[model samples]
Target: MEIARPQTDARPSPVRGPTPGAVLALLKPITWFPPMWAYVCGAVAAGAPIGERWYLVALGILLAGPLICGTSQAVNDWFDRHVDAINEPDRVIPSGRMPGSWGLYIAIAMSGISAAVALLLGPWVFTAALFGLAFAWAYSAPPFRFKQNGWVGNGLVGFSYETLPWLTAAVAVLGHPPSWTMAGIALLYGLGAHGILTLNDFKSIRGDREMGIRSLPARYGAGMAALIACAVIALAQAGVIVMLHMAGLDGHAILIEALVAAQLLLMVWFLRDPVSRAVLYSAAGVGLYVTGMMVAAFGLRGLAMPV
Candidate 1:
């Protein structure tokens, strides 16, 4: 069955400025949590005293979440307006709530603000934010438009959301690159995030097929895509669990093992009815996934502290 797409007007509206609620909707505050949480995990894993310069920590969280992440959301929504007419018509741009090319304007302005804030945090953080902003534009805009291909697109978003902010915060606290061990852990979690992101593809298969978006579900079919997504997530976290055990953090490894096991059970349910249950699995599974991230961060922090 063909999904009905809402009628959309591509012409910019004449409204001078959209209301603040529209702007907020464009920025998508709900999408901010992942990167923010990753930043905090990095800070904790760095094991540096934070109370003295707590404000810097706070700033890093802002850069990771509301600034950089929010900017990405705006950029995505603007470029995705057409696809969203079918997948999510109520979105700011597609719904005409953000008038007069305001979505693009906000993305550009937020990119600048994110850069300015990142520069304040220091060069490494600034560099990370630059890469994030670059990915944001490329993932959505012309010339690159990585979102056309699920593999490249999901990889970029996962890394930007998980790996980049993580290292940025770690360097902010450690005043340099993190130890390879910490970097490796962050990489693993970011890789797992790819699968988490793929879960989002299931929601838009009809629209993506019509729009040539080639999301996992659109490309590979729901059951196969669900299996692949679960595999990617499981393998990535399996690597983390092994790394933790090798570091003698047996208890933390055990906790993540339990989390993964629980997630596996949830995956079973999601796989049985992938289209309707995708969001449900994401809610339950991602909670456990991020919990494991924090648990591993604590393990790293414990390793950093001396007896």
Candidate 2:
């Protein structure tokens, strides 16, 4: 078997420091919303009074979104700089906007900061943060660079992005583990987000294949990968609806079912040209999916409250 290597660009002289804008670009601020929203959902699902610990809520959000998630982005960019050279040459690291080893330094610094913030939040939050951090590194770094395989990579990202942050937020507020219902909802959403992560791989199929990354789009071909992504997302949400209905959350179940129905309709259109329509489905269909996550979280709030 021929070994494939990531294509790299000529190294430039290390810059003194990256500009603030470059640093922010490397962190990918737009990517922060999913985990931040998941944290908010978890907090709400915990059913604790926010009035008493507004500061903790804010801190938890910061930890989950900008600190932890941003660190992961930095780590990924650092390790995948060569890959980006092929897929997105203009990205900060490859373009030398972040320059030299600054990306690695930033990832390490943010990892420490995230740990400190998680420590202040609570033991459970700290534990979850540690796990998230571990997966963050494993997803991008070699040896266990999970990103080399689509199923493992996407699953790890989804869990770290959705479930871990949700659990951390719940623990931060409640000072204890979340209820079974809350945990179940978070897990289901996390599983569904695997499809979301796979959708992200669509744009980089060529680079992935060239570099032997084995992403879903690269391995199964775009059409089959699209079908698999849609099926996984639908099945996870279907499980959520059934669980919610059986738990006496009829209103929430009905709302989620409606959302799933709308997503299925969109999926039909998306399947027609999965490669071109992936981003469109991500924006529209995935938007509905996350909204339904919030709905499920709210339903669990009632169960979390003191009876």
Candidate 3:
């Protein structure tokens, strides 16, 4: 017997094309902060004088946040409209706010726009953008829809949102590969963001399960998943602190340790009711996590500066 799929409304396209406002809503501007902030951290970590390269910096930020990240959001929404119909019926695509295949069209259009903007940034930035854009599409669309598996999906998102943008910003600013220290920090932080992505899955557990999406919260019970997320985040951060100490960035290590401590405390509170508190933990705990990232960036900058 064949497995049943979730039934989605077959809505017709609007007589008119998507409005500008509907297209903007499809981009999900609120989801842009993490990548943009990561790009800024990378720029700081590059230890380059930005006095002459302000235009490049600005363009890199735009690419990271609005173009690349926004494109991902649009693609995910377009491909996941059926799931969103159950999880968030009010969403623009599912609710017919944009209607029919317009969501898909918008995503495809944005992908081209992102590539054009990336090429203007630099070859390194353009290469990173292509990788990010590829992951964005693979995460949501086609036979390789990575979102079906929780770990793979979350890991891809973490790397795309954090490490890729960080590398792009560093290359844009310094016109070379970032130092090993900066690269290492970006990798760790990107890995740690797996937990953040897991937390986001909490909000869609019901829809994910019903639609046969194997998100962590849907496959493993929310409580167990919460514990796993806490462990992943805490351990990765512990590794970062150790690496910082080994590098003799004592002040930065201490600051990051304090931030991690605070995140652990918040995690305890979040675990008390994981499903209900996922958003709160994401906003509060993840905020501290990114702040620590910025601190580490500043420390790397000091080390990268000329003696």
RMSD of each: 7.8, 8.1, 7.7
Writing each residue's lDDT as its tens digit, candidate 1 over 246-268 gives: 99999999999999999999988
Clash count for candidate 2 is: 0
Query: How well is each residue in 1-307 modelled by candidate 2, as lDDT tens digits?
Result: 9999999888986658999999999899999999999999998988998899998889988988999999999999999999999999999999988977999999999999999988987778888889999999999998999999999999999999998888878888898888787788889899999998889989999999999999999999999999999999999999999899989999999999999999999999999999999999999998999999899988988877888
Q: List the residue pairs that clash in candidate 1.
A: none
lDDT leaderboard ranking: 1, 2, 3
TM-score of each: 0.94, 0.94, 0.94
**Which portions of model 1 show Cα errors greater than 4 Å?**
1-14
Whichever of 1 and 3 has more lDDT, that candidate is 1
